[model samples]
Target: MSGGVDSAVAAARAVEAGHEVVGVHLALSRMPGTLRTGSRGCCTIEDSMDARRAAAKLGIPFYVWDFSERFRADVVDDFVAEYAAGRTPNPCMRCNERIKFAALLDKALALGFDAVVTGHYAEVRQGPDGVELHRAAAWAKDQSYVLGVLTAEQLAHSWFPLGATPSKAEVRAEAEARGLSVAAKPDSHDICFIPDGDTRGWLASRVGAEEGAILDRSGERIGTHPGAAAFTVGQRKGLNIGYPSPDGRPRFVLEVRPKTNEVVVGPKEALAISELAGARFSWAGAAPADAASGFDCEVQVRAHADPVPATARLEDGELVIRVEEPIEGVAPGQTAVVYVGTRVVGQCTIDRTVSAVPASR
Candidate 1:
């Protein structure tokens, strides 16, 4: 459990269904006794205690598994490396892919557990081939986008007890009715590790900020930058360029070149990516029969971003996606989750992107 209302209600439902449920809280923090700043970070010392109380009320076994080392190596380190390489990564996706499913699930199965149940707002349905991942009843709270990295095996052994819930408020009410202490606990926000929510400052501590040049689309130096890695695609603020365009239009970060320590800026329209591809990817359930060939699918870059109409295909070793409706502010290392209707097909870590706007302008 996450020491939140959603997971507490999920555990209550599982116990009410007469299943032998065990509440496992993962200790992912490297530092001991890390406390939650309001509802910022999760899986802290305070959260573990809350999880224990919820488990006690539900009459289930509770254990705290220390996966701090693995989490640091996989999620935290990878996040820093990606940003240093001028790529934007979603740490939650990496945690779900590597730590939660791969590490936690493997350990659970070895301990004779049938599956890992969580409070994620998603659904797993039994399809003809196997279990398929789908969005929850409430589209606003659907978390299937983040769970897109689960493979067929992972999907088979996963359960989302809060999938059918009408709303988050109802989950809180259920937790209160069950006398769970976490009924009023707020949800975690931003990156859990960075409790303060200052991403650029956090990265600067590790990446080491250095003065660099900011260039325009035509390779003309327009301004100076503190560090190229600190900026992301489509960023307008904190550039410190102090220069307006000839047309008086605000310039947006079009690219970041860590190799040369250069930040490229252009018009906002240039942020739209025509296509993106990645070599590292996995299917949520069964691979599409037409995956190697070509098939139409909806592509989502960010967790809350709207899905766009697209055509995807596996070419050589990469998953190439061409969106009919262009996606803006896309950066390498971000995941592109593909979907067929409400079912999650797969997701890939974006390795490269092609700007929709032509360079001739």
Candidate 2:
């Protein structure tokens, strides 16, 4: 429990189902303590106290596990490096895959727990073959995309109590009815490490600023940005360039070259990506037998992006996908999640992308 309404209600539901539940809180070192000014991120010292209070109200044991070192090595460092390389990395997915499932799950099993549990908005159902991961009933809040990195084995030993629940408001109501302490705590936002929402600023503090040139499609220098690390693919609003097209067209970021420290801008059409190559794949269900051949399914390249019609076919040790509908702003190092309806079938890291271009005159 993160000392939030969803997790508090999740524990209550688990208890109602007659399962002995123990609350585990991951103490990520990057989290700033409450004494630190403006530290509102989850996993902070204050949040842990709230979680402990909730566990007490539920009459269960709660302890904070120190995974700070592992989290820094696995999640935080990887996030910084991926951004530096001009790829949009999903740190949540990495936390699920490496820290939560691998590290935390193993520790849970060793401690005699049958399975690790979370308040995530997703579901796991067992069939004759094995367990399967599915989207939560709350479509808008479904987090199956980030949890898609779970292995078949992990899925078999996991439980999500809020899988069938509705909005967090309902969760808070349930908690209030039960008199839980965390009924009114706000939800945590993205990138728990950077609480102020200044990703570029935080990166600059860690990696010294190096100015770079901004370029157009034909490699013509048009403007300048603070640093290539400060920008990302598909950004348009913060280019800081006064250059406007003769026809009053707007410019958008199309590329970031770490090699020469250049940010590229062009018309919005340059953002289209037709094909994607993903590595480090993990199948939520059984690996598709015909994956090497081909399989038709819906794929999502970003967390909130809708699933688009696509085909997942393995080739040359990567998942090469052709999205039927072109989705803009796809970037390397983001996750590509495949699903059949509500069930997550597989996922992979986006290694490359190809978009359609207009024919030369």
Which candidate achieves the best TM-score against the true structure? 1
* Displacement of the residue 257 alpha carbon in candidate 1, Å: 0.8
Instruction: Tell me the TM-score of each prediction against the true structure.
Output: 0.97, 0.95
| lDDT string, candidate 1, 243-340, tens digits | 79998999999999999999999999998899999999999988999998989999999999999999999999999999997789999989999999
lDDT of 2: 0.84
Question: In angstroms, what RMSD does candidate 2 have relative to the true structure?
Answer: 2.0
- Per-residue alpha-carbon lDDT of model 2 for 172-214, expressed as tens digits? 8888999987777777766887766788998888655698899
| Candidate 2 Cα misplacement greater than 4 A, ranges | 30-40, 359-361
Residue-level lDDT for 87 in candidate 1: 95
Off by over 4 Å in 1: 32-36
Top candidate by lDDT: 1
Model 1 Cα RMSD, 1 decimal = 1.2
Candidates' RMSD to native = 1.2, 2.0
